[model samples]
Target: MSVLDTRCVNQLYLTLSNILSISESDLRQYVIDKKFELLDIAWSEIDIDEFFKTVKSNVNRLKGNIIESVTISHLSSRLEYECNKENIYNLYSALTGETKLRKYLSDVGIECIHESDVISVFFHGERIDWKQYEQTPVVLMLQKRLGVTSSGDKCINGFLFSGDIHKNMNVTHIARIPEFLENLLRILKVHEAIYFWERNAQPYEIIFKEKFSGIIYDGDDSLSLEDKNIKTIKHCISFLGRNLFNEWNQNDNPIIRLKDDNDVLADQIISSRNLKTNRIIFK
Candidate 1:
């Protein structure tokens, strides 16, 4: 079985505890001590700093406390154990954090299944080739650094990244980018490129720097506000609630492209894999 590091365990514990309102001490008592046994590791094998830092970062990020109450209830219904908070916490944390827990739970007649990974992120309308860049610094920045700020159904394997070839611009908005990046990716489920134009940036260009790139449009008077594209942009604003719209629109950044002129943009979205044809089909 693959061993989870202390950092991963802490992330799992803190995330589940925050969502379910179960304290860490309770988690240790009811789950770690009684339900499943964890393998001991040497001190030198663990990054002690990362272990504590992850715990601290999880605490800070959860300060917002935005995980909806209804979500917890819905998750409780799907659990295999008693619906009480402690059992629910153990069930969910085990499913996510420990492979050993799966075997133990299965022995007790709980159905434990693993879901296939979903490529939930897209760059410049393409699926990210994560394997090729596993050792690259971009992976560290985008995955490790950005992950500290990510929320909602957090999983290590859910995101994807792809984009244009311009890898030289300074990504000044990395912090703000994560706030709306996941929502923008979900919007791409039914649409293509979500273009945001800044008054200072060039028109119809995908700017790439700091290992990321995205299509941008300049909301200039020369480009009439009455244009259909502009109307579509507004439609997107109205469609995606005010909070998400404001997140993307802050600091003069306005969405300029969602679907292309001929609706060819969705073709770039990876919706289905046609194995017989050896091609990816879009939404």
Candidate 2:
């Protein structure tokens, strides 16, 4: 009895098509097959609108299934050599064009503040409060300006302005493409570490904690990584990765330690209890 937003379905179709490089007919056939196999229903039984409503309701799960299928079919190496530090940065550079990363981010309405080893990113301009307007138009315009057509390119413009992917809500802090990509790549690395740990049959919590001791900590004595959930730990890792990317260039060793300033900013953003006080906080 609930109405579904057709636009969400359309965008998901386009996104999957772009990501998989499949034609519309092929995608349609694939969906039909999937529905038959999973739901045990003929495609003719349901109206197209109802089918799209189902997809909209389960978009995240569908996306995950597709990604897992792709990974199983093609990415045998997984994150080992493919997702190395160099390769990730190269992909970032390629998406951002020839201009420097900071400059490209600034051009697309992101403000970067560099203080010592820390680099803080925020949404800039007069309209600091983005909660008032609808987010789809804002996201579409920003994506056009940033030339974000490929799924390979990180497109977090919606979440940058609005707090969530549905683009119906707002947040105090927001991050554009760079931070989104950084967080994604860092999570990939964490997955790599998890794979390694699992394959080696290593002890669970203690050794895993040792591997990421200093990198995940934000210099806050009270807030400990050991006490945090996997999601929070991944976020902290991405924060560290972003700071490291800003401070060190391609030629530097990728395993450098986080400096004092980086820890200070991390403490302010991640450890600070204030989450909903709108005013350009970290994403």
Candidate 3:
């Protein structure tokens, strides 16, 4: 009745068709074209007997071997077939716009789908390209996160794997994606190594570096002769370093760099409170 219910019913149809060796697209079209015949059957009032009788005829006529013999005396016996009667009913509901099959599945608390089981019966571990779904939002999200542009990337069907980089930004926004990824992986690896190396390592949190800046010092040559000018120069240099550190940490993007002997940012100075850790870490 609702949009979500409609979508679930559609997915239920597709998954069932893949299970039963039927064409979901053809079945959907058949139901749409022959709505008059299906509407008179009172699909909402379907019992086990009514469902079996209605589906047995269609299955026998459409594909012949799909149901074999539907002279089912018991629901338990119906499960003995290569394709169970309940799944056949799910396919039927998908074809005829009925909700009873989905309702029956929900009532029995058996809604989870085991992908391994489906693949064993239908695909046997062969890769299915499903090229039609390339335009879907789910695929696009994976592309953005994993830096997948085409199908041939090292990603496992667009899934992010180790050594993958988040290259969604342009070269202007993020220069050298490969180098960025290399440094990112190195930083994460170092964090992981340190975590395992320590006996009391807690879970590490991520820290992102957004921007970088530096303060410029300008003074008259006449003023350089005084101790006050020299002190001011030292203080200004310290202030510039502090400003640059703050600017980098103000962003949500992860900063990639090698650590020094103290596991610090090498040349940068930042407070522990900003990263919430004595050492910088990444996920």
Total backbone collisions for each predicted model:
3, 1, 0
Query: Model 2 clash tally?
Result: 1
The best candidate by lDDT is 2
Off by over 4 Å in 2: 1-99, 109-127, 133-260, 263-283
Q: Give lDDT tens digits, candidate 3, residues 95-149.
A: 1233442332333332322232121011223332334344555554333332334
lDDT by residue (216-254, candidate 1, tens digit) is: 132322433224222222222221222222222222223
Rank candidates, lDDT, best first: 2, 1, 3
Q: Return the candidate ranking by TM-score, descending.
A: 2, 3, 1
Q: What is the TM-score of each candidate against the true structure?
A: 0.16, 0.17, 0.17
Note the Cα lDDT for every prediction shown: 0.27, 0.28, 0.25
> lDDT per residue, candidate 2, 47-133, as tens digits?
434434433433322232222211000000121211211211223333343434445445455554433322323555532232333
Please give me the total number of clashing residue pairs in predicted model 3. Answer: 0
At residue 85, give the lDDT of candidate 3.
Answer: 16
Instruction: Give candidate 1 misplaced runs (Cα > 4 Å).
Output: 1-126, 141-176, 179-283
